[model samples]
Target: MTETHATNPPGAPVFPPGRYGRRREPGRRRPLVPVVLAVLLLAALGLGAVRLYTQYGDPAYDAQVITYTDITDSQVVIDFRVTVPAGGSAVCLLRARSSDSAEVGHEEVTVTARPGERQVTARHRLATSERPFIGEVLRCRAPA
Candidate 1:
């Protein structure tokens, strides 16, 4: 006759085991959809930024001084041509400068192009404070 003690038998296994339980389900993996969407979103934002910079960073209208005359002691007449998008009104800033490049006069003139015409010719007479040695267009733009 034999008695079994609290301790395991010498030949008995210390613990019963087969496969350990997983910390998480192996079939349930990290989703890849969110990562792909994040990348696509970033790419789209970058393209939009590039497009905006290219569109607004540069001047849109083209201008040239066709001719100028009637340069009096305190006045000047300027004739210029502007090429811009049709159907929109544009504002042209004119400046009269002395031989030393000092501003003697300034004027903001507005012009409206025909519905299908992008080029327009204009002649304007501006008042000045002194005799202007040079009169030209400072800048032109479509009102926002």
Candidate 2:
């Protein structure tokens, strides 16, 4: 008696027709998508950083609080120094806070630097509705 056997190719194993669903070929990915997306993300981040720096970061009009004294139930005296360009002026925001971090008072003060002067010291008396625990110079900007 003689016996017969079936042979298959070296590639993927063959399945019986209709027994399994049709197979699909691997699809190609486009490399441009990720590059475009990354460029867009970076551009957005750069724009945001530039806007923030322009709005809040001015090295020429920097301000620092030197001392806070003459504290009372209804007022506080804030002594601060502002660094401005020579012969320039700056507008500073002053704030007073209570012991609980509540805003007791706020005011905007303008300081001017004389000729050949880059730093100017200013003192402001801020009025409040309640007692203040601290006085601070929030920020300074070039005068408009």
Supply the global lDDT for candidate 1.
0.83
Could you estimate the TM-score for every candidate? 0.63, 0.61
For residue 30, give model 2's deviation from the true position in Å.
16
lDDT string for model 2 (1-144, tens) is 322224543564667655577655557867998999999999999999999998878656788999999999999999999999888899999999999999999999999989999999999999988999999999899888
Q: What tens digits encode model 1's per-residue C-alpha lDDT throughout 24-82?
A: 32365777999999999999999999999988774478778887799999999999988
lDDT of each: 0.83, 0.89
Positional deviation of residue 120's Cα in model 2 after best superposition, in angstroms = 0.4
In model 2, state the lDDT of residue 44: 100
